[model samples]
Target: MSAAIFHNPLLNNGPDPWIVKQSDGFYYMMVTAGRHLALRRSRTITGLADEEPKVIWAPSSPGPYSHNLWAPELHEIDGTKYIYYTANDGGGDDTRRVCVLQLSGTDPMQDEWIFKGAVNAEHPGLDGTVLPHKGELYFFYSGYGHFPDYGSAIYAARMANPWTLVGPNVLITAPTADWEKQGGMAINEGPAFLRRFGRIFLIFSASATWSDDYCLGLTSISESADLLDASAWDKHPGPVFAQYPEHGVYAPGHNSFTISPDGQEDWIVYHAYDYSEVDQKRSESRPRSTRVQRFGWTDKGMPDFAKPMALDTPLNRPSGEV
Candidate 1:
């Protein structure tokens, strides 16, 4: 039971981080590294530091996605590989949109990634992620609302295929709580899905990332209910994960989850901002790092996230891994 306990900030300056266990038996990580897209692969999450990031794709021509790339996520659907990300040219929100890249080769690093165009949200949007439940594929993402203060809100629709949108964008969660409004933006974005106990929980980050108050909130829908119906969702009252300023961990949101190698334990991977830093402007300049912690379920089968663990304390790795 005595496994190695690694430090927090697993990879410094890594924000909007996402890790997926693919068919290759390796963990693939994607994060916002400024303007271009990059990927890191490792047998274990702790081993990620041993490997240098492989720069997979950078736009060669100048256009809508030529600059400011953020929140890149990778997925393999059917037999093809796809990547979802947000970017824009210098022309402001008009150019900012959710775009995708498709790969022909197995290895994303060595493959030729073809531009697949934007998700066609009809409004300014970002953080596009896909989830397939039952027999339908749904595309979930964050979009700019009509109100200026509604910097972003989570929305989704059934997808006809990987890159094609089928239904109208249904608004899932808008920032109605005061905790969600920070740094002038009432935001709810960075959605990740966890399906269990006959329910689908859409866990997402809320508030501005630039602010330390940035955290996570949860909304769920019954598996038997109509997922496309906005009225079917049950919104949690507050954030499931938030700042632990006493432990020097702040803005602990924007998360993704994966099961253990033996499929016995569930682990959640996320990035957290430093708490001691006072300068909000310069604080964001410091790189956010990726961390993982074990999470469990309540008696009622809801996710028991508890509290954000202390930063400096060492914790054991997930159940069964070398």
Candidate 2:
């Protein structure tokens, strides 16, 4: 697997990537635009580049969730597949909210997305992720406007049902530390959880989303510890992954992890810019182009994610395949 083969953006103009490994040997991915939910699937991670994504769902009315769709994640729970996403009212920032939709068929490609209505949270939240930990299920999302500073914070709550939180939101991670203070202000968003090696780790994107300094941060609670207790987990002082000075990939954020076809290799899929010359606040040019790279552990067993590969690197198929 040459680096050149893995360098191309898997999906151009796509932002806030959410990925899931289906049982039928394919990877299903979705991201946000203002109007509709775009979806794509492929056998190989790189194969998603050539695959044409479709608008699987869209706003049927001009209401609170009619526009500004962001960070759409697909989850399979109790034999049903659901997509959790963030949306704002009528494409306005003031009405931003989180909602879930149910997919009818077993195959995500069949296009049977049915609106499941909104998931009630204690406050306005975005980037919702459904993760099962231990014998319980939890809903992790980014808290927006709940704090006085208006900075994004990561929160969690037990899920009594797949679409509803059972209690008040528990604050997990915030941007008070120095490492999280880069890019003008400290903002922590995009919460994704992974239970690996008997530890429950929460991976969140940090820094100002529009800046080249945007990157990932991590925190974890031991399997034996109470996840709802903020003091039980430890937060890494630095980023887990971020922009590469030499590669020129900028503002890499809002990512999800997936396993290879053989389930032996880990890959991080996210959105980034091709050049660093563009102004950080330019929304038009900051399209969330998709990219993927191998992820693993360091010598101390913490996550070791290398600099993102250039947009044209060639890589082999995941291990144990052609």
Candidate 3:
């Protein structure tokens, strides 16, 4: 018997890749759709691109939440499913904020998607994600502000509900290191949550997305600690996963975690560029493609995301892939 094999760059032009496996035994994925929200479902991670993405939702009017859509993340809280994504008018970065959409039925493809409105972060931000901890909902986002430099930073605020944010936005992390402050501006965004062995980890991206230096960073706190307490969180000094230029992989960030089909392995889905797109002058226009690879945990309980694999490498498909 032979193992199934797949290649990297699963979908060209796919950026900010996000994948979440539901109880239906299918993987649902969404990326930066630019003008609307869409989802792709597949039985195996690598099979996602084979299915035509279903446009589940789009703005009904030309308003604040009508344009520049990016990074749609699906989450189920309580019993309702919601999609949190970044959007804005044509007004640019300061106008960008997180918006929500609710599913009217179990089937995201068949159900109606209703606009729930913009989250009240009180400050403009992007790449919003939810963390339901200790029976409460907390929202994590990249709030636009000055951390001594004009750019984005990570913030956490308790959500009054799935679509509304309440209380003060607690600063979780900001770009300070040279690596994080590359490509003209500092940034720390695209937050995702992971739990393992009594620790809750927050994985995020740093450095400007257009820069070859863009990469992933991680922070964590004890499962029992006060999640909102800034002091309780420990930030890893360097990027946990970064570019492998020698492998023709660059700017690998905006990642999401999901388990292999049979629940036997952990996989990371993200987007990056090929060697040709390494030119910083034209990097912003270069299309990023979604890629996935399985990862492991360390003896210290930290996720070990090795360097991004080369674009042409043929690797065995995730364990139990259908």
Candidate 4:
């Protein structure tokens, strides 16, 4: 199978992309901003760029998360599909809150999303990712405050139910290293954890999300170790993926991974900026745009994200007739 090439800013004004492969044989994706939560679906993974995303959920009142809906993710657990996202009530950064909603139909497009309320936790949270590990459901998100410096850290907890946390949140990773210190902010946000080749790998977006230095960092835990243990996970010491020097793509982070139609290939869907000067502040130019690329496994069985390809280039499709 040949690799496919897509460009930065795949969507006009989208950011914080979250993608899920639905049982109905379509790729459903969502992003932050614009009146409501935008939903996109496509039969082919690469074809998503051409599909018109619809607002599945919107804010009715003026509040912190009312206008700025960010990082919306869809997960199907125990025969029910749930949309997890972040928003603010008063239309500012401080009011940003993580919330969840229930989708009515089996198919994401035809379904009606109902507000399910916020997931209970200690501090304010954003970028919620729901992952099931070993028969137990786990929620991974970014936590603020606790650290006197006001840096964001990755935290996780068991889920008693799909929309609720079972216990206190556990701190998994923080911005203690140089790689995570960029854009003048000690930050660790946008966490996505996966197990491959007997190792539990947690990939996170690091650096100041608003700066061009925004990149991805990796941490790992042995298959035999407890994932909730902070000591069990080892930080990679550097970024797994970041901006492309020659391609002019910058601030590439907050990504989601999914399999192709045949279910044999791995692809990453993320947002990036075409211009280097666009800071993290929300704007038309800095809108989180979606892009996709083939993910290769290294000799050690970990993801080898050497360099992201240009979004406008065309490459070979994954194996299996697509």
Candidate 5:
């Protein structure tokens, strides 16, 4: 089995794209469609864009989950598929909160997805995601106690179940470094987990997405230790993955992990803007596109994302995929 090497910008444009390869040997993916929730079905990762995405859910009225939906993560827990996303009215940040939508069946594309309500602990935030690690369910997201100065930082809390967070949120990381304070704003968001190389690392997007300086950061935790304690995490001092202007890729952030078809190789799928989109970002009319690349590890057991390659460059296919 061999897989093809796909180019950058897997799709035309979307925010917070995620793909889940299920036991049925198909990939179920969904992106923030703004006005509605649509999912694409593909047998191969490269086939995602060409598939006719199905619209599974949408906001019925002008209330809580009405507009500004951002960073929705789809997961299967206890044989049920669920989606976690940030939503708010057209009002402002104060109204922003994380919400969940649960599917009636195992398959996300065919079953009816019902609104599970807000998952945040009565706060303002977005990009909510949950994972079951070491027999415990934990929710990780970017949020704040107060806006304007509270800014957006990474937070983690224990969850009693998929649709609920059970305790006070712990601040994991915020925009403290100079690189994180780009475009006159400091933000740490889009937290994604990678449990490998003898540690559990939190890989999140840093800085404002609109800025060319937007990049990725890394924080690690011991697999045997308590994840609820904020002090147990170790954030890397700098960006793990960032823009490569010479390659024409900028603002590479908001990433998710997957494996090659044979399940022997690790891959990363993320959204990044090209140099051409930087100017258009002023009005935000143009959108960032998702890209896929194979990443490796250093001798130190850390992930080496290398540089963001140009879209025109050719890359080798993932090993053992066909």
Candidate 6:
């Protein structure tokens, strides 16, 4: 039989999409569910939308981590599953911080998710992600800091464990470029690690997510370099991925990377608006749906995300789909 086809906007109401294909030969996905963390599993990359999302974790009462849950990412370390996400105490943006959850039991859907508490307690931020290298763990997130302007900037700290951040947090990248300061905010958030050709690439979202100008930025450091050292990273001057107005795609940001089912292809899962319908009433809570498309690596050892595709475009499914 011929391989099945897929389209953009895999889900109509998913933002900050995070997906991981595990050794069990299944793809698990998690996105921003506002008040709780949810999980979906499927055999194919495009099948995640068809799976019923299981509420793996939800707050029992209003507290520090009881409101504004966003960007939930699932990662496994030493045979245990942990989720790193953003949450707040139902206050303003300053209360937003990265929190973690630990899993008990074999399956995520049937397991109990225990709160592990906030990371980097002194520093309030959002969008926490993990990068493991050479038997060490590094945690990256968008922390509330001033880069000559009061807004969020990318920060990194060494992880003592899945939920604890050790040492001082180092500033990685800031919103200095003109493109990074759009929609009345200067921002550099959503840091995701992509490793290729023995180098670690830091891909992050820039500008305000609610703005049509929201896009993706890039930076990198050699695998052997000290990840916590801010000087060791080389920041890209321009966005590596941005809106494709001709294709009717807008504000693509907060991305995660996963391999094809057969582990032969690289795919990017991100969230974007279907069209430019900006209004005075717009906010981050606006429905930004999830999308996925295969990306290619450059001969010079870099990622080429190309341009965002239109929602109606029919594309071949990921290679080796079951």
TM-score head-to-head 1 vs 4, winner: 1
Alpha-carbon runs more than 4 Å astray in model 6: 1-3, 146-148, 277-286
What are the TM-scores, per candidate, against the unseen true structure?
Answer: 0.95, 0.92, 0.96, 0.91, 0.94, 0.96
The per-prediction CA RMSD against the true structure, in angstroms, equals 1.9, 2.4, 1.7, 2.8, 2.2, 1.8
| TM-score pick, better of 2 and 6 | 6
Task: Kindly report which residue stretches of model 5 are placed more than 4 angstroms away from their true locations once superposed.
Answer: 1-3, 147-150, 276-285
Model 3 misplaced stretches (Cα beyond 4 Å): 1-3, 276-285
Which lDDT tens digits does candidate 6 get at residues 1-322?
A: 3448777788988999999987667899999999988999999999998999998888899998899999999998888888999999999878898998998866877878888889964568899998888898888899887445848998888889988878888989999999999888999999988888888999999999878989999999998899888999999999999988899888999999999887899999999987684654345555899999999988888999999999988888998986
User: Compared to the true structure, candidate 4 yields what TM-score?
Assistant: 0.91
Residue-level lDDT of model 3, residues 166-226, one tens digit each, is 8899998889888898888899999988999999999999998888889999999998998
Give the 10-residue window scoring lowest on summed lDDT in candidate 6: 277-286
Please identify which of the two predictions, 1 or 5, would achieve the higher lDDT against the true structure: 1
Q: What TM-score does candidate 3 get on C-alpha atoms?
A: 0.96
Assess each prediction's global lDDT (C-alpha) against the native: 0.84, 0.80, 0.88, 0.78, 0.81, 0.88
The CA lDDT at 33 in model 5 is 78
Writing each residue's lDDT as its tens digit, candidate 2 over 1-322 gives: 6543455577778789877787667878887776788778888676776788878888877888887788898888877888899987864444676898897888776858888777777767688888777778888888775566547788888988878788778888898776676777778899877767878778898888877888899999899887789899899888888888588688888889988877899888888887773555567855768887788887776777788877766765566444
For model 2, the stretches where C-alpha displacement exceeds 4 angstroms are: 1-4, 91-94, 277-283
Give the alpha carbon lDDT tens digit for every residue of 218-239 in model 1.
9999999888799999999998
Ten contiguous residues with the weakest lDDT in model 5: 276-285
Indicate whether candidate 4 or candidate 6 has the larger TM-score. Answer: 6
